[model samples]
Target chain A: MAANNEFVGGKVMTTLYQHGTLALLVPGLFTGTQTVGELLKHGDTGIGTLEGLDGELIIMDGIVYQVNAMGQVRVVNADETVPFANVHKAHPQPKIAVEDASSDALKQIALKELKTENLFAAIRVDGEFSQMHTRAVLPQTKPYPTLAATAEGQHEFNATNIKGTIIGYFSPVIYAGAVAAGFHLHFLSEDHVMGGHILDFDLAKGNLQIETFDNFNLHLPVHDPDFLETKINAKQAMRDIAKAEN
Target chain B: MAANNEFVGGKVMTTLYQHGTLALLVPGLFTGTQTVGELLKHGDTGIGTLEGLDGELIIMDGIVYQVNAMGQVRVVNADETVPFANVHKAHPQPKIAVEDASSDALKQIALKELKTENLFAAIRVDGEFSQMHTRAVLPQTKPYPTLAATAEGQHEFNATNIKGTIIGYFSPVIYAGAVAAGFHLHFLSEDHVMGGHILDFDLAKGNLQIETFDNFNLHLPVHDPDFLETKINAKQAMRDIAKAEN
Candidate 1:
């Protein structure tokens, strides 16, 4: 039953939080028969099955948890012996603690991890023949004005400014006969210092060209050559992963 | 066909966007048969019908527009004239007006907009409920330092620190035999000084909760009383409109 929905099976990409905690979406792991606690104890190595709403079993990391009709995550694998450990236990609880942090703090931490992992480039399919790409980087200085004591002892500061460039690519995929086959790509080259976590993206840029196919063109920035290389590498990795899983 | 979907048959909501603009999904809008150009021409007074993927025909103004499998828009009303007043026109060619402007200039503009718009408050959804509920205020002093002196100063200046407060609610609709019929709600209250758009909202909060229901209770940031009132008012207006149409 789980094999029917071939598109539903995929590895959960892990993202780290400011406190050094991890979070990832485990697709097709909700079977409604076990709690998140139970699933965590089952370990991550074995293939677990979840019963989908359509009555199909979804193969996942051998663990089952329940998610309500709404897409919010209810339970997580909370086993005691799991590797990397859930650092959320000591505070007001993992979810609450992380959720309560400043967005800037969280973003900084997340981006730092992504840079360390070299997963900073983002790519999306725009149409059959095009792809959009961008990167995140850390600014050497802040964008806002600093507060300084005046002669009379008054202090003042102002907002910071930041900019990100979105570069697009026209690929050979457009000639594949599909009405639309393109991708949107982004790279987090600038570090977002506020969130404490590096920016992680969930993409939907690949399907954009179906509506704007006629307006296809490449807009190269001054850093285009290097950015293009990163885009190509990212796209290749994505294709390889898709092929391997299929 | 349009009359069947409306109460007395002539009123319908129309969304307008300029051609070439991205037709962003607005949750309730039926994506079928709605095109960017067509929506712009829908006009302040015109009759048209829109059909969703579910085959449910939503009266556009007074007539129905047939939607194709590709989500293209086709006008069905021969007599209704769609005005061109609100149509958004895109530049026929890319214009590089700021070829020499540093990235820092752009960043500063972005930050100014964010500050004026009070985006920081809107992004801080995880803070305490009271803090979240309070309207966003532009700080008299800038929080971060400036990068305007650096080569990438403009780029850094545009990155902003915006915050939002996510609020949840459950409202009872009607009392039934053994169950109480009600809907769950989530919303976000945004305060920005630029446009004076202080949204006291319930629908926004309700919508957020619905989308994030799984992790609702665990996330912090309490709901605002005033904003909740506004949301309730909005919900009532929607209910009235829905009822009148039926």
Candidate 2:
């Protein structure tokens, strides 16, 4: 019974998408377009990828899955193409609790329930998982090397008591190397057949949802003639996207 | 004709807005409402204020000035009321000149043309200011005395050889105790009669414009039943809003 005037004059319409920048996908510049049916006609949830880089994406509630490349997950056709994403549209709040921590101690208890670390949070933890280590990447074409050489070789998965729901984001270490500098999660399994992204887990309890993003809008592809004629070499592409998107 | 397919699929539908959180406007929750004529519907530009903490706002291009507290500057009034702000919406890019610089060297040359700093940018420059330093507060009620003690009195103003267009925002330092962590400007000269907020300026050349937001939406007033039952005491309200909203 408390959402505080649900954002009176402080405004809060929530809409996020960074698209391309890790200094332009580590200089590889992988193309993009097939926008996920216009981000599911106004988001319902998020996580991203697809479009040639074929694989790993999760959009819960509004349906839109795709894990591909051997590790197989599925759901996405009608020609889904979105290259990178980070959707949002669930403004519900109030749902806390859980047990075992881990995953950097749930990012220091969601950084003390996000007092500050430079805002941007959308963590959802739904339950059941004594173990979980996911990964999913495999799809790149036309000379694309960075993204730590296309995430070197990802295809790891482990699940124990699984039900699932991680879908996350914290983003702030000045966007470390461009994204995932602070936190980034992605997982799905409510029988939608396993998931990807997330790299660690434990969560003893379940049902945790946190949302905090305070106004930010950045959309740039500059009509892409190589997105401003690529040249990005920012310190070895922020050290290969801080060791492959952290 | 190179908008680079405007983010083809990399997706970039930015929209940032973190309305309330300096631990709930430092215990003094100065009531809010008029929502800046509804954030000028799709934003024309920004910088915030108005509710109780009367004066000093700047909406530029989409119109909405203020600056009260003695310094008097007018314009806003479509039922204005906003409490805090940070608008955007103008993806036209390509305008650079800026000279003499200062203001953290134009934020380190706009952080190297903003490659990344955890996204959120709208900096416009325009130009022709030989000098400028502004402020403008003076409007609070309900025993409110935080905000670095009502910004310990503010009303400074200075201008000379001016034309105008400062409306700024950079935000990222975990929203410096909830907003205005990194950069936050607000000047409007050009015939709209001097403005406020910006605390310094010297631009030499003109035309600077830069936009980037990548999504972020945080609007929480929760129907202000004391806004989620106020309780924020986070290190003296984040050292009094990181020393008065950065």
Candidate 3:
């Protein structure tokens, strides 16, 4: 779904929310044909943004929903366009678990599994989270500010007793702009009532599912006239992604 | 200008080929509006394939050309579509020059200047070469085979007394599917008589111009039905790219 989403080429598959390379949804450039229904055909799980970055998109178990600007999560229109997303079929590993672990500590365990930075991986954290902090960017209009600027206006949320799965991608630093250099994740409650890119969390009891992808395939938005004409500055974008995603 | 050719924030800049994520040219996908002229707007140098995999696309000093399957070089039509290309503005580093240098030795020098592999870089080696070997992929059509399969039919060339620039990119391992994990170079003779994706070469003497990209931006071809439907196997594609480009 994003950079390092591949392992030289392997059997595991993973998708991501818009990688930094394809991040920053261009305003007025929506109306895409890649819908949730279409995306589901490719993978059963992933994250992305609705057309115009209208809200956060969370695709889990083939169903799609949007976390609107009001922090309300609801099933989305199947025909709605998805300008950017990262997803993959779910493949949970039952061997890893933690009853009480901070997000930072859990990430260390995941890193141990990584072994090397070159591989692309998908992570799933399921169970109850005693505490979690998340954020989502409100959609923008034409002349959209850089993703970093939009991130500055992110809506923050704090939740407790949240039962859901945290989904994300682990990219290498080399892919900084192509995708997030490191982990880029989003959240979805079991009830589909809460979701957005995750910032921090504490799991009272959670199990981790890790799937590694050896190879990656990325399809870009070429037909969009604005995408064709834009003069992109990647350095700043990487900075913005880091500031916002982390 | 592909995915990394971003207008998103008009700020994020990145350089990746249609290298190895959204690298390959899919079948039944053509009539791209992102022309050689359009690519030139972003940078003056790069390497890619023309629409329908017509030929090798080499853009040097702002002019784009195709090295056909027959090994004949000619200026490409500005309107010609480029399905996949890797390009960036020229950055001539006079201090990085070597006389009577083999391509292998020269690469070491460039690596030293790199200092870090985290950034995307465009490398230009301009000078005389005692011997050079290059190859190009013929344009393709609908029901296109995987790039690895297409590589089996690649056309190769060997040359001496060649002078001009070798244009290409250096991506990190994590971006293997998105860009070449290492050096991916293309040759364009100063006389505009020959060029192709690099295979091997002996540079009698050459000057190295390495431009570091702080960020990367890319656009995926989403409208292509195949892009949306195909189950990408990045592992095999990377292998194929290695077989063809290296």
Best by TM-score: 3
Residue-level lDDT for B57 in candidate 3: 76
Runs of candidate 2 with Cα error greater than 4 angstroms are A1-46, A50-53, A58-66, A69-82, A85-193, A196-246, B1-46, B50-53, B58-66, B69-82, B85-193, B196-246
Off by over 4 Å in 1: A1-5, A8-33, A37-246, B1-28, B33-246
Better of 2 and 3 by lDDT: 2
User: Please, what is the whole-model Cα lDDT of each candidate in the order they appear?
Assistant: 0.19, 0.68, 0.66
lDDT by residue for model 1 (A1-246), tens: 011011112522121101000000011111232333432331221111122221111112332222222211222334311111110111111111122223234334333322321111111111111111211111111121111100112111111232222122121221111101222222211221111111223232122211101111111111212211221122333333233111
Second chain alone, TM-score for each candidate? 0.16, 0.35, 0.85
For residues B16-65, write the lDDT of model 3, one tens digit per residue. 43422433432233335256766666577788778666767777778887
Model 2 residue B77 CA deviation (Å) reads: 25
Candidates in descending DockQ order: 2, 3, 1
Model 3, residue B36: distance off in Å is 30
Q: Give the per-residue lDDT of model 2 (tens digit) for B63-175.
A: 88887878878888767677567666666789878788876788788878976564567788888878888888788887776677777787788887788888788865433
**TM-score, candidate number 1:** 0.16
Q: Per-residue CA lDDT of candidate 1, range B1-246, in tens?
A: 011011112432112221110111111222232332344332222122222212111122233333222223344444322211111111122211222223233223333323321001111111212211111111111222211111111110111222333221221121110011122111122331111111222111111111101000010001212111111122233333233111
Could you give the DockQ of candidate 1? Answer: 0.01
Which one wins on lDDT? 2
Give i-RMS (Å) per prediction: 25.9, 12.2, 14.2
The per-model DockQ list reads 0.01, 0.06, 0.05
DockQ (0 to 1) for model 2: 0.06
